[model samples]
Every structure is written in C-alpha cells, then in structure tokens.
Target: MERHATSAELKARAKGQLLGKYGTIIPAILIVEIIMFAITSVITLPLDTQTMPGLIISFIIECLLQLFAGIFIAGQTYLYLNISCGGNIRVSDVFYGFTHHPDKAILIQLYQLLLMLASFVPLFLLLALWMVIDSLYMLIPITIAFCFGLVASVIISLMYSQSYFVMLDFPDFSAVQCLRFSRKIMKGSKARRFYLDVSFIPLYLLGFLTCCIGLLFVIPYMNTTYSNFYLELMSKRNGGNVQ
Candidate 1:
C-alpha cells in the first residue's frame, strides 16, 4: 500500500532541502512568480469599464494574459519541484517549463479556471435574484445558497489541486487523465491538504505585514512545501521509500 505523508512532514523535508541554498532558491521562485503578481495587480486595478466595449476588451485581455500566466506557472511549479527533489537549480529554471507539454498544460488550467468561474455563477445568479425580489425573507435563502456554492467550490478546487504536478510528472497523461489521477491519489486527503494550506496562512499574513518583503521567503517556502508533498506522494505510489 502507498503511504501518505502529513503536511508537517512534507514542510519539514522541503525546508531541509533549501537549508544551504536559500539565496539561490528564493530568488528563482520569485523570478517565476513575479510576472504573475504583476499581471494580477494590473488586472485588479480600477479599470474604466463604463463602456461595454471597454469592459469586454479589458476582460478578454486579462483572460488571455491570465491563461498564459497559468500555463507558464504550471511549468514553473514543475521546475521548482524538480529542483526541490535535487535537480539542477538555476534562476533560469523558471523558464524551463515553457518547453514542457504546453498544449495539455493550457488545456488543464483552462478547464480548472472555467470550472472555478462556473462555481461562482450561482452566487451571481442568487445576488441578481435578491436584487429583483424585494423580500427580506427571500434574501435569507439566496444568501444561504450563495454560501453553499462557495463552500462547494472550495471543496471541488482542493480535491483536484494536485493535477498540475501530475500533468508534468506523467507527460503521457492527458489533461483529464491528470485530473483523474490527482483525484484518485488525493482520496480522503483533501482535508489534510487544506489543513496544510491553512497552517501557512499566519506566515503569509506576517509576510504581508512586512510590506510584502517577507513574501520573498514565504512564497518559495510555501511552493517548495507543496511540491515536496506531491513528490512524497509520488514516491510512495511508486513503492520506493520516501526520503
């Protein structure tokens, strides 16, 4: 039987991996993620969307950029994981993902993004319905439904969170196959993964408090921990002893 590692174990292992190379590791991760942060900041800034055409054009551009970012980052995450597992580390390692099976990469990320967006559709629908109906009584139910949708989305998203790692590690797998493999491997461990993520929230909050300077360390640690977790799971699956 394959053994599953807890979040604590994975984080410790990853931290040990980075002990002698913080200077190199941290900056490499930042190089990959910086573009993502910049694009997101631009997307969120107050846009003059008073006109329909302006809104549509802006939305289209943002969507395309986001899609491009997602694909490249999926590759970068693979890069980081490989490095964490003792592959050659370089600042340019972030760009190495561009040569991966990119078409499948885009497909998987696009589907996941679309599915997440679909999850919010109910919230919007309920909000619109509440505005049209002038009843305090109906407002209560709409709000309840919206809350349920949000929770469901969280669960759904977490369940397949390992798909990116799978897609890269198993290049022969299609996007849907990668997703299915993630779902299978993650069985009964979604909450554990969620717990792993939640444990880092405080560190992230503290990092933000440091004028975002601390994120230079925090983000790489977080990303490495996640990648290590995937690696341990993969090792166990292969019946090899996890290091």
Candidate 2:
C-alpha cells in the first residue's frame, strides 16, 4: 500500500525537525553555503563583462561554480537527512557527507548542473529567435516555448527533489536510478508536493521583504523541515521507523 501525509502533518514534522537540529547544524550549513557563493562570485567576476569572450568565459565559470555549489548543498542536505534519521547532528557531518561519498555527491551535483543547463536551452533559443524575428509572429513560438519550458521545469523539480537523500542513503544507486526513485515517490503525490512548494513561497516572500536577511532563518528552517518531511514519507513507504 502507498503511504501518504497531509500538509499539516508534514509541516509539523518539519517544525519538530528544525527545532531539534537547528542549534547544532544550521549555522554551519549557512556559513558553508555563504562561503561557497562568495568564492563562486569571486572566481567568475571577470567573466561577467559585456564582451563575447567575457560572456563565454563567464558562462563556463558560472557553470563550474554551480557544479561546486550543488555539491556543497547536496552534501549538506545529505548530512541533515542522516541526522534527521538516527545519526547525531554535527557540524562535521556536513564535511563527512562530502568525504564519505565524494563520487556520488559530485555525480549528483553534475546531474543537477546539467539539468539546469538543459532547462535553459529551449528558452535561450526561443529568445534568440525572437530577437531575430522581433514581431508578433515571434510571440507564437515564444508562448509555446514558455509553456513547455514551465512544464519541463516542474517535471525536473519533481524528479530530482529527493536526489540528495538517495545519494546519501543509497550510495550504490546510480544517479539515474536515484532520479527514477524520486519520480516514483512523487508520482500520485503531485498535489502534496505542489502544496509543499507553495508553502515555501511565503518564506521566500518574507526573505525578499526583509532584504534577504530573513533567509538566514527561513533557509535553515525550510531545509530542516523538508528533510524531516522526506524522511517521514520514506519511512511510511518502507514501513520503517524514522530513525
């Protein structure tokens, strides 16, 4: 039998998980992410110029930075998920997540980077054609492109949502297998996942409203909460305890 959780139950689980682990891990994760972003910005700065060469260089540098950041973020999520299970949460757990499963973590990161690039190709081509056409006729293809692009984005989100956990918990599984497993878990549960995504909208808005300072709290809160939600869902499906 398939198992399910209501939005309220998920939210409660998230809250409990966040409160339980916030003091031990959130600060470390935030610091690591901030440092990674800063380093990425510094490495890619020269590539952001207006020239063609600069643009090309910037694109390449940006892609590399995203790959690096994805690894760090995915590793952090893995550590957090393990903690959400039975393991003790520690600052070092984040580092261990990378060291212990370096290859899988990097592969997962690469997969994410590729998906991001793939998602933009169509939109990029559509816009390029629009610039060339520069007319009402361009709107037709652009609109169609936009709809397909939106659907693709959602599908990608659903497919890869649980990838970090898969990499962490099921190290033997390949990236494609992990992605397929995530999609299967999400199947017949689109409405719940959509609601979960929607629930984060207010947090994002709050962050925006606060000049992004709110993110310091909101990001950790959301990450921890979502980790718990993922654990609960998996536990129910496998008929196992959360620990």
Candidate 3:
C-alpha cells in the first residue's frame, strides 16, 4: 500500500536523504557547472570591433554552445542525483538520461524552453508598443518585463515541478503523459508548490549574496531533497511501499 506523506513529512524525509546520501557530490556538481559557464563565456566573447556579420556569427555560435551546455549539464545533474541516491549511476550517466529517454527528455526540455520563451513574448511586445507609443518612458517596458517575467517564472516552475521525478520514475511514460502526470500530481496544490518554491527564495538570495559559493550547499540540498520528495510521492502512490 502506498504511504501518503504530509508536506511537512515529505520535506523532513527529503532533508534526511540529502544529509545521508548526496551531500558529498554537491561540490563536484558546482565545479562542473561553473566550468561549463566559464567555457561558455570564453567562447561567446564579443570582438573589440563588431562588424554586423561577425557579431551575428558570434551570437549564433554562443547561443548554440550555451544551449548544448545547458542541456548537457542539466541532464548530468539529474543522472548524478539518481545515482547518488543509490541507483547505480556513473559519470557517463549524465548522457544516459537523454539517450535512454531521448524523446521524453527532449520534449520536456523543449516544452520548458517554449514556456520560458512564450512568457517573454508578451512582455517584449508590450515593450515594443510602449517604445513606439512613448519612447521617453523606457521604465514602462522595464517594469512590465520584470513583472511579467517574475510571474511567468513562477508558473513555469510549478508546471514542471515534477519533471525530474517524471524522468526518473516514469521512464515508460510518454512526454505528454509525463507532463500530464506532473499536472495531476500537483493538482489542487499549485499554491502549496508555489509556497515551497517561495521558501527557497531566501536560500537563493543568500547564495547570490555569498557570491554563489552557497550554491555548493544549496544546489545539492535542493536536488537531493527533491529526489526524496519524489520517492515519498511514489511510495504513497504505490501503496506505502518504497524501493
């Protein structure tokens, strides 16, 4: 029988998992992500003198590199989390996440990207309209963009709150099915998820304030906790049984 955990219990169990199994890998993941970011920055540097064609080429190359790196890093992180939690993982397990479930992972990534991009479209359009209507009022676009971006970010996070879990736990599920399952699992709990996300805001700000060193701890904590949360949910759905 599945064991249903209250949110508080879920959070506590996740914390325990983080402390026990995945704590050591936190620093390594941070180093890897930082190295990736650095490489991306170096490759995307603007030339001192930017001709239009040169600038365009550089921009495209930079964007492509960034996209590739982002996907690879994210996939690797998921793999690492799964393995670290005792799933018999390896270094190459990162690539395996995508390779093993190419369609579903790709779809998830694409959907996430589209949602992010779509969220900005309206703000951008409003900004353009504002520019045309009142060029002197540049603040309008800035404010609107900031507000819309904030709201959109929250929505996107909620929508994909269970994406990693879906990827790990429901490999047999199609992309659309995984998305739908995430929605169903999170149903009637958008506000609760939002609140959970909000609770992390302070840690995020603290990491920023500390020049990201704090992420060495925060990232691992969040990932492991999230994995544990997934386990808890799965256990509940599967009749209080966890493997």
Put down candidate 2 lDDT per residue, 27-135, tens digits, no spaces: 7767787788788778876564788788888878777776666567665786667655656767766675557656666667677667766876887898988888788
lDDT by residue for model 1 over 1-243, one digit each (tens)? 546777788888878877766777667767656777787668756566788777877777777776776567775686567757787676766665577777777777777778767877877787777788867887777777778878877887787888888887788999899889998878877887889889999999999999988987787788888888787777776776543
TM-scores of the models, in the given order?
Answer: 0.85, 0.86, 0.73
Ten contiguous residues with the weakest lDDT in model 1:
234-243
Clash tally for model 2 = 0
- Per-residue lDDT of 187-221 in model 3, one digit per residue for the tens? 65577666666667788899989998787767766
TM-score of 2: 0.86
Candidate 2 regions with alpha-carbon error over 4 angstroms: 1-3, 240-243
Looking at model 2, which ten-residue stretch has the lowest summed lDDT? 96-105
110 Cα displacement, candidate 2 (Å)? 2.5
Candidate 3 error regions (>4 Å): 1-8, 20-24, 47-70, 73-92, 135-146
Ranking by TM-score: 2, 1, 3
In order of lDDT, best first, we have 1, 2, 3
Count of steric clashes across candidates, in order: 0, 0, 5
Best candidate, lDDT-wise?
A: 1
Error of 2 at 103 (Å): 2.5
Query: How big is the positional error of residue 183 in model 1, measured in Å on the Cα after superposition?
Result: 1.0
